[model samples]
Target chain A: MASIDIEAEIRAEPPARAPVQRVTLLAALSWFAAAAILLLWQDLTFQPLVRELALIWGAVGVALVALGLAGSRLGRVGRWTALRAPWLLAIGIGMAVWTVLTAKTGLLPQPFFPTPQALLEVFIYDWPKILHSASFSVWLLAKGFFFGALAGFAIGVGMGWSRAVSYWATPLLRYIGPLPATAWLPLAFFIFPTSGSASVFLIAFSTAFPVAVLTWSGIASVNRDYYEIARTLGASPLFLITRVAIPAALPHVFVGLFMGLSTSFAVLVVAEMLGVEAGLGWYLQWAQGWAAYANMYAALFVMAAMCSGLITLLFRIRDRVLVWQKGVVRW
Target chain B: MVASALKTVPQAAGTEINIQTVSHHFDLEGAPLPVLDDITFDIEPGSFVALLGPSGCGKSTLLRLIAGLDHPAQGQIQVAGEKVADPDPSRILVFQDPTLFPWRNVRANVALGLEAQGTLKSEGHRVDEAIRLVGLTGFDKAYPHQLSGGMAQRVALARALVNRPNVLLLDEPLGKLDSLTRMTMQTELVRLWQQSGLTAVLVTHDVEEALYLAQRVIVFGPRPARIVADLQVDLPYPRHRGDPRLAELRHQALGHLGLDSSW
Candidate 1:
């Protein structure tokens, strides 16, 4: 009797989300069409991953149809599904086009644009090597970024607070801050004991400049009234800097961090390709040397995913810290 | 249950403020822009006095000096018996804007003075007490952006009141509020002042507001402000806005401000 009542309640709930939206169906149809094209029509012997990809697409299409039939059971996720339906359809259509152009015909030629299966094959066969290089790059990046951001924050705060520091630092920052980290690569490699250290220096230099510039700007632009309020409230100089200045300027610091991360990524790739023996960047160059374009594409994929993942993580931290600044800005 | 550690402090609740022929100027593109011109007055301890003036007349600057956030270029200003050279927790100034820190919630904002003084650990309950005193009992977790203007201003008052300042210097604290909210806040201000027994010095241009709230209204002239008149409001506490004596005092203050209506 209880089970029957639960089923009745489930069935009785009205659709609060869009009622099995047509866009979801369109998305499903597009994905299925991509799968069908991959399965039914091919100009070459398909790799295992290619067939697997088709199966995944077909499964995804079926899942979307089921989700749409489930109405508002998932609430926010259901609404998101409706909104993202266009993206889903576009991705499916894009995949179908990629398949038709690459393995299916010589319309776009070969080697330059590796077939979808060829790219996936590199992922399957070269998983261990790819993982090793990626982890190494991340470890190097983490070290450089952590120290660079710390140094930048301290420098920025000092420059903002004291006239003597600002006067001394401003000229130095102007001279040293804007030079490309890659420009220092050859010199840095010669100066440092190891390639690892050289790459770290390159990444660190790239990360620190933007972070320092933005952090200094942030601290300098803090409202004067904030200082007055804190002063009258018995705040010491230390209190003024830590409690008043830092918290007020954090939003700007986060913005600096975002710019720093991107610049560091660029420097990391350049440094690894030129100096370091192993990393995704080095792997990319190695694959190209051998004319293994599929392997190169695979390394590129890993790099993109890593870069975007780190950025998303930064955004998450910013969201948590700046909860008070609701509706101010979102990256 | 935690005991009130704040009670252990020996600072008195109200102290006298003395302004002695204070003159000050600002550098506007290499030229001297006089704001306060030989301003001289004294505020009685534990009473609300308003410095009534026209816009840009330097009454706000005078309040800033009394709070020790700024110094007089020429003459001296004293509090209790000592010269006020730097800002101290004993005299908290509420600015025209609430100036509540955007990063802090109401509780933390009110607790700022205690935190800065290294007393928050023992005297944290005073923060809650101060928030409640200003009628913001449940908004302790609300950020400054989450609050309305009047509520933010109340948080500012709580932030000041939490410090247990002997002298509360208000530089047009209620000037930004809507008329309806302003009316309610004026009543609350009187109640807060009367209950706390703090020396309250408010700076405002509103003739009626000055007449309504202050025990004495010191009217000032235009820029490089000089005292034109110091009219005493001999009205009782909780004075009505529509009181005839308030209207009479308003006329006198307006006359000094050079806005006396011929009709």
Candidate 2:
């Protein structure tokens, strides 16, 4: 072989391939293949499960396209040129058109779940009722969260701030905290005239106790040096407790609040199942008694979505308040 | 005569204070072990002195006694014409550790001494002036975590200075620092002492450090420690460690402590 012109060859050669691009390409291709396979096999799977899962993937694909095309001039394209967005929009339009056409002409023999007119009735005439039900459930959850978080924070602060309380009350709390709030049904029904008040009280009580205990434990676990330095710096006992101790123990307190909130929600639903005539749990119970399985399932979907949203909001608040404690891993 | 003169001189200075033969012991679980014995010392007005000894030689105990942080069992500790039995801001003690509050930043730490004494209103200048004197300007907002060890200790020094005490007790303040940082701190300490003109009692183990910084360095022996030597530096302010006289004195003092084998 002819001797290579080293300098010229080196100068003419392309840059060495980066592993990052290769890995990213592999990941993107794998994800696209999985989505395509899932979407194509939608008809062969359990119809309800397939529909729910397809909706989730379709939402994801739509979201990607929407976000990608939002700031760009891609929207001006006549549907074909814009790869991500066009594909998503075409799929949605095609599905809507097919559903309408298939109903107008009885072409595909038998349909799954709801016929076109039934789905239309649920979407149009029954929409107002569904909205009312969802809103009522959300309102109940909001009330439970507010009362639960407040009581929990106070109890936590009290227990955490004082050693005597934490020492004496912990054993009692450990026993009480684990016992489900539903166990108090007989007593609650006896004391309160209506199940509504009893439900609210039971949920709040269950949430507050654990929140308070966890907050107190967190405060107690803070480093002794923090307190000693405060003393040496001439901070009065009161000032030390309020300014230094509380702020330092805030992270743990919030965690306790979040935990309490989730627990309260769970207890609220259980309480509704036993007692109340309102709220999402009450609605689910009513639907189940009427043998309306779809309504019961729909109510469940609403509960899941609402709880996820509320929990996300709580975490956001936790992150904002405890930003300084970022990089410090918590147990 | 010197003892009699030391006694009478306090009266002449118009301060009716006396530190009679003092001794202290540590009692651990009802077992008493003596640490210092018959430690008789009288401080005159506006005097800068250093208590020099090796580690575990009870130099810190002597400072703590002066600050009223510790009580002497067999003797008396008098400060500014009065006896001391409890901790007070009047006779401030700066321990070896910076001990700055981790929560409070530099400004708050400096203001602490005045706040504790309830003299904040009358002595607002003290806090600002002390912070400025310590060369920690523009670091008011920095927390202890943000500060280097030297800076944190400087804030501690400022806190003590803000109290405007009759006596300043330093218990090996520079002992924790590395050699370079320690040398820098020693210079800063001298500047502070000269400007403040308050009576200071430094407890240090370094012979040269004590000699260079203090007018008098009181050396102590091992366990149940007592003053073994009271060597006077007699050198002028802003002393040079490289000076032949300082080197010779340091060498001789080192000999007394079995430190300079060449001697």
Model 2 / residue A39 / CA error / Å: 12
State candidate 2's DockQ. Answer: 0.22
**In model 2 chain B, where is the ten-residue run with the lowest total lDDT?**
B6-15
Could you tell me the lDDT of residue A145 within candidate 1? Answer: 91
The CAPRI class of candidate 1 is medium
Candidate 2 residue A92 Cα shift, in angstroms, is: 12
Reference-based lDDT, residue A83, model 1: 61
DockQ result, candidate 1: 0.76
Q: How well is each residue in A1-331 modelled by candidate 1, as lDDT tens digits?
A: 5335334434544544435556667778888998998888855644457778789889998988876666456777766666677788789899889989887875777878888778778888999999999999999899889878888888888998899999999999999999898999989999999999998888888888878888899999999999999999999999999998899889989998999999999989988899899999999999989999989989989999999999999999999998888855554
lDDT of 2 by residue, A252-278 (tens): 788777787788778878877777767
> Candidate 1: which stretches are off by over 4 Å?
A1-21, A42-54, A68-77, A329-331, B1-11, B261-263
Report how far residue A194 has shifted in candidate 2, in Å: 5.7
lDDT of each: 0.86, 0.67
Output per-candidate TM-scores for chain A, rounded to 2 decimals: 0.90, 0.65
